[model samples]
Every structure is written in C-alpha cells, then in structure tokens.
Target: MRFIFKTDYDQDVRLAKHGGHVFWYGLLLLFLLASPWLLPEYWLAQLTFVLIYSVVGLGLMLLAGFTGLFSIGHAAFLGVGAYTQAVLSNMGWPFPLSLACAGLLSAAVGVVVGLPALRVKGIYLGIATLSFGFIVEEVLARWESVTGGNGGMHVKEPSIGAWKLDSGEEFYYLCLVVTVLSTLAIVNLLRSPTGRAFVAIRDSEISAQSMGIHLARYKTLSFALSAALAGLGGALYAHKIQFLSPDQFNIVQSIDLLLMVVIGGLGSVHGAFLGAIFLITMPQLIALGKDVLPPVIGQAPGLQAVVYGGVLIVFVLFEPMGLYGRWLKVRTFFSMFPFYRRGMFKRQKSFQKSDRLK
Candidate 1:
C-alpha cells in the first residue's frame, strides 16, 4: 500500500493526492486516447454512448449524491438540451455556441424546477420532479412547430470551423474531450467550498444553515449545475444519434440515469464512469448470453427488462454503495489484509433520536 504524507494545505487539496493516483489516471487517459485504434467500429460507437451517459451520470451524482436533492425529471433537461442544440444547429449556429445555449436553456429550466422543489425533500421532491417531467413531455408532444411532435426532428452533425465531426471516430474524440473536461470540473468542484457546502446540506440541511450556508441558493445552484450537465450530454447525444424524440427522454430514461449513479457509486466521480460502462455493456452482454442459452430462456419476452431490474435489485440489496464502493472495500481489504475486520464493510443502521419519531 502507498502512503500519502501532506506537507501543506496545497498538497492536501492537490488533485492527485498520491503518486499512485497520477499513475493510474494517466494510464486510464492513455487507454481512452488509444481506444479508437484498439476497438472495432461497433464497440467504438458503444464507447461514445458510454461517454455521453457518463456525463448525465455526473450531473445526477452532483445533485443527488452531493447535495442530497433527487430529481426524476433530469431527462426533461436532457430533452431541452437536445432540442436546443437541434434548433440552434438548424439555424446555422456554431457547435460550441449551440452546445452552450443548450446548457444554459436547460439550466434555466432547472432553476425553475428547483424554486418550488426547495420546499420539499426526499420522496416529495422526487414526485414533484416526476410530474414536471410528464408536463414537459406533454408540452413537447403538443409543440409540433418546435419539437415536431410524434414524428420527431432531424439533427445536424456537429462541426468546428470547416470540419464536420461526422464519423464515429471523430465523434468519439469529441465526446471523450467533453467527458474528460466535465469529470475534471466536477473533481475540482468537489474540492471547493461550494462542494463542501453541498455535502454539508446533504448531511444535515439544518446544520448547514446554522453554519451560514444558504439552503435555497445552494440547492438551486445544484439543480442548475446538474441540469446544465444533462443538457450538455443531450446535445452530444442528439448529434450522435442524428434524431430527436420526446419519447426518448421519458421517465424510463430518467430511471436509467438514476440507476447509473446509484449502481456506479453515489458521491464518487469514478462511480459515474463505472456506471456508464455497465449501462452500455450490460445489454450487449445479455444479448450475447441469450445466443448461448436455451431457446426458452433466450426467447423470453422482456428478458432485458427482467435482467436489468434484477441487477438493480441486487445492487440495492447487496451493494447499495454500488460497484465503486465495492471496489473500495476490496482495495482497502487487500491493503490492510491481516488487519481487516469482519464488520468493516457492513452498513450502519443507526440514526439520530429525532429520526426515530417518524
């Protein structure tokens, strides 16, 4: 095991705490850079999607994981971003400008949603967001002039200057760059006072307020940031898919986004990436397994749904902290092998006396 000795506050808050972090992150970056050369065309497309989903996961993680504010209407923000990008690109806007506008529009909607949601918490907020999503869906369906209603709308390929990012490889690189930048931004945010305030609110909103943290401002900020990330992801997704549909951003998609962050590991940036990998790869793996299994098992209707739900249930029941959390436990266990305790990974069930009232 490696040890980190902090000599100063700067060293303590450094992005890479130890030499091992630098080495591993560098290696991961190198792998991502070379993935296009290593993987086939089909896998490359899947990887691009993984990167996009990771962006959405990061957004949800920021809001729910860090700020303790959950939303089930994130897909509505995604739809907003996708439509904004589509409309702007159709109007001949530059890719960068379109993307920025998409994010801003989505963030604006997020602030609107957060305003009333600030009065609620937990399940109530989730329900509020869920209703908001349905309302957005209806609006998209009726606004045929803009969203194209049930027929959907076509999206133009993103371009920079005279160069079009038309090919999968080009798009993969674009997504990679965005995903990397988003991840770095989140990591740095978590290391800042705002992120700490978010965590404080998560731990205890009352206590955070006692410490002079403005609950409404920070809560709204979290929603805006989360929605902006979703919008950015949606913009990329629209260009990648070359199509837009309100149905694509329905409650199911929102649930999938939720599952990604929850299964990846709440409150961990790496968990978002891990969750994205799982979300993209699991379906393909299931299909591959279907081909090998007996006809009855393989041909079962809704097998994908069953398997997906089962996996989520398993993760919730056995590994609530998700894949990253499990990995952390394994790493720690090995690092302190002989000293590891049996109850080390067990979940704590204790709560405050006030929480016992209801």
Candidate 2:
C-alpha cells in the first residue's frame, strides 16, 4: 500500500491529493474530451443524456447523501427547470440566461419545499416532497396557456450569442462542460466548512447543532443548491428531447432519480456519474435482454420496473454503501491481495447518547 505523509494542512483539501489521482483523472479528462470523435452519433447522444443525468445525480447526492435529506418529489424541481427553459427559449432568450433562470427558479422552489422540511424528517419529508411534485405536475398540466398542458411544448435549440448548438456533437460538448463544472462546484463545496457541516448533520443532527451548525440554514441551503443542479440538468434535458410534458416529470421520474443516487452510491462524487451511466444504459441493456428471453417475460409491460425494484432490493440488502462503495472494496481487495479480509468494509453499530447514559 502507498501512503503519503502530509506535510501541510493544504494537502488535506487538495483536489488531487497525490500524483496518481492527477495522472488518472488527467487521462480520464482527455478521454472524455475525445469521446465525440470516438463514439458514433447514436451513442454520443446517449452519452449526452448520461452527462445531463450526472448533473442531476450530483445535486441529489448532495442533498440525500451528504445532508441526509430525502426527497421523493425531486422531479418537480426538474420540471420547474424544464418548463422555465422551454418558456424562455421560445421567447428567444439566450441559452445561458435561460439556463441560469431555470436553476434559480428551481432553487427558489426548493427553498419553499425546504421550509416545510425543517418540521419533518424521514418519511414525512418524503411525503411532503412527493405531494409538492404532484402539485407541480398538476400546475403544468392545467396551466395550458404557458405549459401547453398534456400537449407539451417544443424547446428551442440552445445558443450562446451567435453560436447555436444545433448538432448532437455540439450539444454533447455543452452537457460535458456543464457536468464538469457542476462536479467541481460540488467537490469544492464538500471541502468547505459548509460541506463539513452538511456531513455533520447527516451523521447526527443533534451533534451538528451542538457544534454550532444552524440546522435550518444549512438544510435549506442544501435543498436550494440540490434543486439548482437538478434544474440545470432539466434545462439540458428539455433541449435534448426538444419537447416538454408534465407526465415526463411525474412520480416515476422522481423515483428513478432516487434510484440513481442510491444505486450509484451515496456520499461519493463518483457515485453520481456511475449512477448516471447505470440510468442511461440499463434501459438499453434491458432491451437487449428482451431479445433473448421468452416473449411473455420479455414483452411484459412492467418488466423494467420489476428489474429495477429487484436490483434496488438486492443493493440495499447486500451493498448499502452503493456502487462507489463496492468499487472501493474491490479496489482495496486487489491492492491487499492475499491479506484481504471479508470484514474490512463491515459496518459498525453504535448506540445513541441516551442509550449510553442509561
């Protein structure tokens, strides 16, 4: 095993802690930059979707993973961004401005939702968010004048001043840039005091409060920031599909977003991208499997849902740490080789302070 002796406090917060991280991440960046040229148009489009979902995943991870907040209506925020983008784009607004507005509007809505979140936890918070999502969907459907209701609305191609991202390749680059920036922003946030407080709260709210962290302020901030990222992703999704529908952002979509964070691995940045890849690619994989299976099994309308639920159950029972956590274990196993232990990554249970006092 390799170990780095830290000589300064800055090393603890450095983006690239060691030379290996720099080299590997540098290579990964180069590969991503060259992917358009390497991949076919269809695959490139799918990759674009992956990047967009990755942005949303990062946001959800921040809220759900770091802050221990659960949202069942995240799709509502996504819809808010999508509709906002569609409306602004149709009115001939610049892409950057419209995108920014989408995120801001979503964040504002998140704050509204977060206010109620202060009074609830766990299942109640989820129900509140879920109800908020339903309300947003209804508003989108009933507000025909603006949202076009069930008929949906076409989204204009994104443009930066005179430059239009009309082609799949151009749009892919745009998504890539946005995803990278969002990842960096989330990473930096996690390194800051605010991020530490979020983690503290996640581990134990009472302890965080005792440490002088304002629970309400940080929780609301987490919700706003998370919603903003989801909105940004929604804006991109609007352009990618070029159409907006209320049903597209309903409860099903929120559940999928939740699955992405959970399966991708909570509390790790890499989990967002991994989960996005799973989100975008799993459908295709299922379609391929359908070709090999019996028609009754393959053609069932609920096959995908069944598979998703089963996989989630398996992950929750066997690997609660998520894909990133699994990856860490595998990597550690290989590194440790003959000396690896089965209990190395096992969870430890702890009693509450009150229990200890008893």
Candidate 3:
C-alpha cells in the first residue's frame, strides 16, 4: 500500500497524488503520442472513435455522475453540434470557428432544456429529455433547408488555415490534443467550487440548497457545460464520420452514451476513456464472435443489442461502481494481501426523506 504525507492544503487537490500516478500517466501519454506509428490503420481509426466518445462520456459523467442529473436525450445536443458543424464547415467556415459555434449552439439548447429540468428529477427529468431528443430528431429529419433533412449532410475535412487534417494520423493527433485538453479541463473543474457544488447537489439537492447553492443557476450551468462538451464531441464526430443523418443521433445513440459512462464507471474520469474503449471495441468483438458462434445465435440482427443490454444489466447489478470501481477493488485486494476484507468496499443502504417520513 502507498500513503501520501501532505504538508500543504493544495496537495489534496493535486492532479498527481504520487510518483506512481506521474510515472504511469506519463508513460501512457508517451505511448499515446506515438500510437499512430505503433498501431495499425484500422486500430488507429477505432482509437480515434474511442477518443471522440470519451469526450462525450466526460460530459455525461459530469451531469449524471456528478450533478445527479439524468438525461436520456443527450444525443440531441450531439446532433445539434453535428449539424451545426456540418453546415458551417460546408459554408467555408474555418474548423475552429465551426467547432466553437457547434459547442455554443448546443449550450444554448441545453439551457433551454435545463429550464424544464429545474422542475423535475429522476425519471421525470429523463422523460423530459427523451421528449426533447425526439423533437430534435424530427426537426433534423424534416428541416431540409438547413440540415439536409433525411438525405443527410456531408462534412468537409477539418482544416485550420491552409493545413488540412486530411490523413488519419493528423486527425488522430487533433483528437488526442482535444481529448487531453478536455480531460484536464474536467479535472480542474472538479477541483473548483462549482465542481464541489455539483457533487453536493448530486449527493442531495436538499442539502445543497441548505448550503446556499443556487439550485436553478447551478443546474442550468451544469446543463450548459454538459451540453457544450457533448457538442464539442459531436463536432469531432461529424468530422470523423464525415457524414450526418438524423437516425445517427436517435434514442439508441443516447442509450449507448449513457451505457458508456455507466459501464466505464460513473463518477470517475478514468471511466470515460475505459467506457469509450468498451463502446468502440464492443461491435468489433461481436463481429469476431460471429465466426465462432452458431449461425442462428451469432448472425441474429439483434445480437449486438442483446449483448450490450446484458453487459449493462450485469454491470448495474454486480458492479455499480463500474470498471474503475472493479479495478479499485482488485488493487485494494492485492495491496492489502492477507488483510483484505470482502466487505471493505460494500455499498451502504440509505433511506430517502419520503421513506423516513412514512
């Protein structure tokens, strides 16, 4: 086991807690920087998808995992960003400006959604968001003038000035830079007062209110920030796929994004990347299984969905803390060795205020 002896208050919020973190993360960074040369083109492409989804996962994690907000329509924000980027890029807008507009427009929509969100929570909030998603999908499908409607839209390659990110290698580096900056931004946000306010709200809105946290302002802010990140991810996604369709950002995509955060491990930044990896690789894994399994089972149209659903159920029931949580347990077991206890990380039961009143 490792222990830290902190002499300063700032040490508590330091990004790197110890030498181990620095060493491991530094090594990982070095490996990622060189991945274009080390990985095959197909794998590199998949990794790029992973990075894009990771950005989306981080946004979802901040809202669902930290702010205790549940959304089933986040894909709407994604679509907003995607269409915005697609339209703007096609109009000869620079990549940076288009990307910024995508995020900003998504944030604006998020604020609108957040207005309704202030009145609801739990499943009701989910339903409201889900409805919003459906509305956005309909708009995308029918609004032919701006969005290209059901025919879809083609996105140009992202370029800054005269330099175009035309190759997979160049695009991968761009994604890497964005993902790194997004990760750092989230990490720093979590270290700030607003981030602490988010955690407080997640734990208990009643308690957070008692502590003078303006519920409406913060909630709206959370939605805007979350939607902004989702939009940014969507902007990247549009460029990666270079095409956009209304169906691409439908309910199923939202569920997949939610599943990514949950399976990756909610409430942990590491979970976002881990979940992205799982999300990106899962379809490939299913494809590989098709060759080995019986044709009736493996070749079924719903096989991938069934596998995804099964994995999600297993994670929710048996590993709520997610992949990161499971990793923590294993790390603790090995570190503690003979002294390890089975129930050391067990969940605690708590009653709601309504239940207590009864």
Candidate 4:
C-alpha cells in the first residue's frame, strides 16, 4: 500500500511540473503577443510601458538580484541608448540599425562604468553608479548638440516596406513582441550554467571565487548585459512616446527603476513585470485611493510622496524579498491550506548566507 501511494505521488508531481512549464508559458506567450488585438489603446500603451521598463528591470534583477550588485545609476545607460537611437534615427539611419547602435553604445558605457567595480562592491559600488547617473544627467542637460540640451527632441517610429506601424495599437504589438522575446531570452539565459554562476557569485564572492568563477569577468558581464537590455528598452520607449528628452532619463528615473525592482521582488524573474506595473501605476492608484476615500481621508500631494517613500521603507523593513516573495508565500500557504504553519512568514532561503543575510 505504501509503495503504491509513493508511486502515485511521484507521478502526480511529474505531471504538475510538465503542466506548469507548458501551460504558463503558453498563456504568457499568447497574452504578450495578442494583447494589442485584445485591449484598448490606453491599456495597450500602459502594458507597453510596463514591458519597456521590465526589460530594464530584468537587467537590474540579474545584476542586483542574482549577483548582489545594486546599481542605482542604470538610468545613465538607458539615457545613452535613448539618445543614441534618437540621434541615429534623426540622421536618416534605418530603425533596426539605429536601435542596434543604441544598445551597443550603452554596452560600451556599461563596460566603462563596470571598470570601477573591480575595486568596489556593495554600497560603494552603488554610490559609484549613482554618481555616474548624475554625471550622465548633467551631460545630457549640458550637451546641446548630441543630446538636444534642456529642450529635448523628437524620434521617428520604426518602419519597413509599405506597412507602417502608425498607431499606439500598432506600436503595442511591436512592444509586446520585443518584450516577450527579451523576457524569454533572459529566462533561457538564467536556466543555463552561466546563470547559475551569476547566482553563485551573488551568494558569496569569497565562495564563488573559491569555486573558480572569475569575479571580475562575470561581474562586468552582468553590467554589460544589463546596460544592453536597458538600451533596447530605451529605444522602444523612444518609439513608443515618439519623443526624447534628457529629463525623462534622470537620477530620479534610475531610483524609480530600483524601486520597481525592489517592490516587485528582487531576484524573481516574474517580479520584474510586477514591479514595473506597480511602480508605474502606484501614483495613479494612490490618487484613486484618495478619490475613493472620504474627504478627510483624501491623500494630499505631499502625502503621495510620503506614501511612496513609506511603501519602499515598509517593503525593505518588513519584507526585503518584495511582492513576488510574498506572493510565493501566499501560494505555498494555499497549496497546503489548513495545514499551513505559522512560520511561513519567516523568510525564503537564499542561495548563500552571510553576504546579504540581513
């Protein structure tokens, strides 16, 4: 009887795993690909923005979530990509070629920025990147020729042959496909041995070093990959808005990206999507809350900023793992149901101890 039950349980687990992989991915692919056809232009535009930042968020996740490198200045690379694409496209270059140039330019900047990582880690690395962001913002504001100075510039949409994608609805499909592909690419990369090495390095520099992983190489590789992805997203954003401005990609924007990564859940792949959505919609949501509430309870403008800051603080203070982590707990709890234990709220086990044990 015991042996029969064991066999049944193992078979059930295998079936569940198979179903999960195929069913979930199938749903995601269909939604991302078909969303433009299904939703109104408003929601489509919102989803496009979500996917755009999600590309950047995932890159940051790979760096901060997997490798323990918290980059607060990734906006600089984003600005580089946006400006490059804008300049190239304005100069009459083809869209695809210009987009490629944008990503490569950001990757070059990422490599240069990563050089300082050889001597710094943790908060110091974060400070270095933050300063880089400020410098980039200053350059963008000051460089009238390349960056268009404080006034900003326009960007042309991608076109090929007779079919011109001219509407938000049309751009929605392009953004969706690009986002889906980027997400899948990252997903595949993370499942490989290289991804595991990235996680191992995140767990412990000393331990990872002992295991023969070149810290400098993988670290720089993460930054380069992250910047490249951010650049791609920037180019997409440029097309989506059909405009470019230095103010759009500023230090505050970099901090907002970090907020998205944190609130969505650091390290979890799906959390990037969640983070982007929340970070984008939070102000709106909070405003709605004010309207929905009684007049006495209405949130003031200053309160919005306070609430935003509070959310970040609360997440970091109470649950450092972010929303996806909490979602996992909710899932595990319901999966077990009445048998759920109280300790479910403790914490998830990370890849390594001591490094980010707090």
TM-score of each: 0.95, 0.96, 0.96, 0.89
Model 1 Cα lDDT, one tens digit per residue, 1-358:
5576667988966788877889999999899999999999998999999999999899999998888899988899999999999999988898999999999999999999999667999999999999999999888888999889989999989988789888999999999999999999998898789998998898899999999999999999999999999999999999999998889999998888998888998878888989999999998999899999899999999898899899999999998878987887788789998898756655332443121111
Residue lDDT tens for model 3, 290-357: 99999999889999999999999999999988888789888989999999988767522143321110
Tell me which residue pairs clash in candidate 4: none
Q: Rate the local accuracy (lDDT) of all candidates.
A: 0.89, 0.92, 0.91, 0.81
TM-score attained by model 2 = 0.96
What are the RMSD figures for all models against the true structure? 3.5, 3.6, 3.7, 4.3
Per-residue CA lDDT of model 2 for 250-316, tens digit only, reads 9999999999999998888899899999999999999999999999999999999999999999999
Task: For residue 37, give model 2's deviation from the true position in Å.
Answer: 0.8
User: Which pairs of residues collide in candidate 3?
Assistant: none
Query: In model 2, which regions exceed 4 Å deviation?
Result: 347-358
